[model samples]
Target chain A: DVKVTQSSRYLVKRTGEKVFLECVQDMDHENMFWYRQDPGLGLRLIYFSYDVKMKEKGDIPEGYSVSREKKERFSLILESASTNQTSMYLCASSLGSNTGELFFGEGSRLTVL
Target chain B: AQTVTQSQPEMSVQEAETVTLSCTYDTSESNYYLFWYKQPPSRQMILVIRQEAYKQQNATENRFSVNFQKAAKSFSLKISDSQLGDTAMYFCAFGPSYQKVTFGTGTKLQVIP
Candidate 1:
């Protein structure tokens, strides 16, 4: 079975601190994505990488950034954590196609104090 | 811009009964894909069913089936003989020409015994 593993299931960070959320996929998919989910707003895309070094900004990319040094790993970084930035973060990977279904990891719930 | 809508914020059904979760989307692109994803308490986004816009027939898998109205841009999920495991947050999503998939606000389903 294809699995996407996250580095942390729950995290707590202080304001102004830097945060890193890691995601790794067992499948050799070419696309990886990071999204933040909130109540009533659904899931909004933050960043996505099509290749090892290529990245694209999604609709909600202001407070987050992404890094993809390897094909199987994608990382979401919060430059300066704030209370408003705390939410459930999800990582997903899929084949590089519009119709390909995405495989997601168990989300990481972050709380910024 | 593509937008997915889930009018019902929450729905409840008795166990072994059938339930339908409503979903509608607005998009101008003719070639696209629609999906219903289930997110349980574990917070893992699981693909429940998928429907291709070009296909006229609805898609089904086991106890889950979709009512896909391409011209109306409505895709609803019907769960027959629902089980306890069927309780979860159902999200309707749309993927247009771009690879990014946008999800609806989600509907929380509760299965009562």
Candidate 2:
């Protein structure tokens, strides 16, 4: 079975603070993604990495950045955390195939105060 | 850009009954895939079912089945013999071969006893 592990399950940060969410996958998948889930708005993509050192911005990438220094790890960084940034962040990985069946980690819920 | 839409924000079903969740999407790619994911309160997103655009047959897994209408761009999930364990948020997703997957606003489903 594929395993996607997130570094944190819950986090709290003050306004304007820097925050980082880490994810690691054991399946050696080539594609990784970060998404934020909010009520009504659904899960909006933040950033994605197709390969080591390669990154792409998604629909809602503002105030967020991503790092993919290695194939197994992907990190999401918030430049300046705001209350509006509080959300459940999910990390997922998939093989570089047409199937696109993703393996997702338990989400990290971040709260900004 | 590919887009997925889930019209129902919340749905309720009696235990042992059936419920259908609606989803629609827009994409220009000829070969694509559709997925239905279930996220429980634990926040772990699990793949429930998937359908290939080129295949005429709908996908099914245990109590879950999909109604895939390629021409209409509609993919709906039907849950049979709904159990309390089935309560969760269901998300509809679309992706082209080896590309980023776009998710719809999820529908929260509740199974009532």
Candidate 3:
């Protein structure tokens, strides 16, 4: 079966600590995305990469950055984690074109103290 | 950029009943797709159903179906004979025939016995 694997399911860090959320997909898809999910705001895109070594900012890209060094791996980075940055992060990948049925990972829930 | 809107924040329905969740989107693309994604409590997100803009027939998957009004730019999800397992947060999404997709604020649906 196809899968998107997130390296961590839960993480707790200090306010100023750097955090990394890793996502690897086995589908060899061209498009990978990072989204932050919140209670009332739903899922807001943080960043997405259409190809390796390429990335684009989404609506809520503030305080976050992403890396796509390889086709199967996309990593989300929180340079300095803040309390407000604590939320469920989801990773998704899709084959580009009209059919963008995203395969998602079991999200990583981060809590900053 | 395309934008999606889900008017309902929370909704409930009795078991064996039917419920409809509304979604609207603004897009200039002639060819695109609409999707209904369900995220169960403490679980991964999954695609429930999708509809292509070029198809006139509504897409159905067992108890789930969509009311796709291309002219109105409205895509609604209708769940028939709702069960307790159907409780989840439903998100409405719009994607172009390319590599981008936009998600709405989502509706939390509760199925009560």
Largest DockQ belongs to which candidate?
2
Cα displacement (Å) at residue A88, model 2: 0.9
lDDT of 1 by residue, B2-76 (tens): 999999999999999999999999998988889999999776999999988999999999999999988788999
| lDDT per residue as tens, model 2, B1-113 | 88899999999999999999999999889988899999998868988998989999998999999999988999999999999999999999998865578899999999999
Using DockQ as the yardstick, the better of models 1 and 2 is: 2
lDDT of 3: 0.94
lDDT of 3 by residue, A24-79 (tens): 99998999999999988888889999999999998899999999999999999999
TM-score of 3: 0.95
TM-score of each: 0.98, 0.96, 0.95
State the number of backbone clashes in model 1.
0
DockQ of 1: 0.67
List, residue by residue over A1-113, the lDDT tens digit for candidate 2.
78999999999999999999999999989999998999998888899999999999989999999999999999999989999999999999988764888889999999999
The DockQ-based order of candidates, best leading, equals 2, 3, 1
* Segments in model 1 whose C-alpha atoms lie over 4 Å from true places: none
Interface RMSD of each: 1.7, 1.4, 1.5
For candidate 2, state the interface root-mean-square deviation in angstroms to 1 decimal: 1.4
User: How large is the C-alpha RMSD of every model relative to the true structure?
Assistant: 1.0, 1.2, 1.3
Query: Over 4 Å off in model 2, which ranges?
Result: none
